[model samples]
Target: MKNTLLIIFVLFIAAQIIQTPRDNPLSDPQKEIQAPKEVHAVLKKACYDCHSNQVQYPWYANVAPVSWMISRHVDTARQWVNFSVWEDYTQEEKEKKLKEIFRAAYAAMPLSSYMAMHEKANITMEERKLIRDWTGVRK
Candidate 1:
């Protein structure tokens, strides 16, 4: 049993050495999404971490398996829509992303796991309406 525990500890330590890459490239503010201050506040609170080029990784994100999951989620979210580079997208792309954002605002976003750790990021119904209304996309 002692040997097994020792092995597990060693494996856990070894896992930390294999750091997952979590990159948030330098973003141009001019390229970021333009929205009313209220809308931007909601986005900054609930969406930017995963959806934009402004991920605020938590301390656990530097640990092993959790880091891998966080990195992958951020990468996938950026692929869907990196609001930090909003102006870089074509108009059509922006429209599509806005539509997606409109849908996501209802309940599918600010992922549950994320909200579990970030209480401040939990979007209220009013905030959801704000995001959807800001997107200018209908259901």
Candidate 2:
């Protein structure tokens, strides 16, 4: 009975994994508010997973029910602030949003848990400094 239950659980997880949605919003640099590539890379690696449309799901996101939670979070967060569609926001709004993003990253909010699972999401002090510096330069 235990073995049967395990198999059922595994199958359910696999099915949920197959249901993960793909929502990659193509980023057009031409339309984006200017920032150094280092800043962009920092945000892409650390923030984009949740804040943008390009979410790189982890293995656990494929598990049953886990995928549902992750999908919901990703969808909701993207709607709140989409870096891929950054240019769509007004100039003042973009600056305000960038300031908010900088504050969150500096405070280590976005990837605190994310870094535990995905080490690459962990920001080095220097990387954080770059993001902060670039955020200041944005008008």
Candidate 3:
């Protein structure tokens, strides 16, 4: 048991040396997505952390395995829809992103795991409706 514990501890320490990128690049406000204040508020609370270039990394995000996981998730989220560069997207891309946003919100995103850590990021029904209305998604 002692040997196994030592090996596990060594592995964890080694993992810590693996760097995870947690950059939040500067975004031009003038080129950002335009939306109503309420809509923006909801998105900021529930979506921006992963989907934008303005992620507010929590303390846990500085730890090893968690940091790696967060970095991967943020990368994936930004790839799917980066609101920080919304104005740069083509009209078709904008439409696709809008549809994705509505669908994700309807499915209770911020993701349940994310909401578990960030209670404020939990999407309410009204907030979801607001997003849907803004995106012009009927369902």
Candidate 4:
């Protein structure tokens, strides 16, 4: 009886995973990154999962039961700051938003839940400094 129940549960989970969307909303070529490769990778790892249209979701994000939550999170994240649409923002506004987001990140505010799940997203002191320095230079 227990074995049968386990198989049913596994099948249910597999069914959910099959339905998660795999669309790429960032088809705009203008959304290209000019930043250093390391910086870009760091941003992708820490920010793109939620904030951009080109999310490289992990295996857990692909799993069915969590796909809904992940999709909602991605939608909200893009609303706050869409890197693909970033070129549309004024330089001043871009600098301001970067400063604001980085401040919140340093304080561990904007993505506490995300950091809890993806340990790599937890900004290191060096990474924080790099971000701050990059933003400051851009300004």
Candidate 5:
């Protein structure tokens, strides 16, 4: 039992040394997607953390296992729709991303796990409507 506990402690400490890539690539503000203040606010609050180059890392994000998971999630989310580089996308890509944004906002955006920590990121009905309206996605 003592040896097992010691190993576990050592493993935890070692894991902390593993570096996780949490890059926020440079993005041009002028080229960013334009939206109303309300719409942008909602997106910034709910989606930016994972889907943009403006991720705000909370303290826990620096922790080993958690950092790894957060890095992977952010990477995947950015691959799908990175708002920071919105102007770089083609028209078809923009349309697809808009549809996806509307769908995610109405269905499962600001994922429950994220909301657990960032209560403000929880999208209300009004915010959902704003996102839908901005995306021009009808119910």
Candidate 6:
């Protein structure tokens, strides 16, 4: 039992040494998504952390294992739809992304896993509706 415990402790310490770079790239203010102030507020509070280049990392983002998860999730999210680079996408890409946002507005967004630690990122039903309305995309 002592040996097992020691091994676990060692592994935990070793995990901390693994670097997880999370530098947010600088984005032009003009390139960010344009929305009504209200809609933008909701998106800023709920979606920006993972979907934009302006991530406000949490305390746990500096820890191991979990930090890796957060970094990877943000990286993946940026690849899917980066609001900070909204104007960089082609017209068709923007339309497709808007459609995706419309669909994700229901429940898939802000991911439950993320909302678990970030209560503020939880989208209220009204906010969800507002986002859907802003997207102007039909179901």
Candidate 2 yields a Cα-based lDDT of 0.75
- The per-residue C-alpha lDDT of model 4 at residue 36 equals 72
**lDDT tens digits, residue span 9-124, model 1:** 99999999999998889999999999999999999999999999889999999999899999999999999999899999999998998898988888498898888999999889
**Model 2: per-residue lDDT, tens digit, 1-139?**
9999999888886676467675676787666545688888887887788887667877777665777777887887777678778888988888788788777767854655567777877888788778778778442
**Candidate 1 local accuracy as lDDT?**
0.91
**Model 2, which residues run further than 4 Å from truth?**
1-20, 26-29, 137-139
- Where is the poorest 10-residue window by lDDT in model 6? 130-139
TM-score to native of every candidate shown: 0.94, 0.74, 0.97, 0.69, 0.95, 0.96
Residue 112, candidate 2: Cα error in Å is 2.5
| Tens digits of lDDT, candidate 6, 26-128 | 9999999998999999989988999999999988898899999999999999999999999999999999998898888884987889888889888888888
Clashes of each: 0, 0, 0, 0, 0, 0
Q: lDDT (CA) for every model shown?
A: 0.91, 0.75, 0.91, 0.73, 0.91, 0.90
The count of residue-pair clashes in candidate 3 stands at 0
Best by TM-score, which number? 3
lDDT ranking from best to worst? Answer: 3, 5, 1, 6, 2, 4
TM-score of 4: 0.69
Candidate 6 Cα misplacement greater than 4 A, ranges: none
Encode model 4's per-residue lDDT on 49-75: one tens digit a residue.
787777877777766667767877888
Clashing pairs in 4: none
TM-score of 2: 0.74
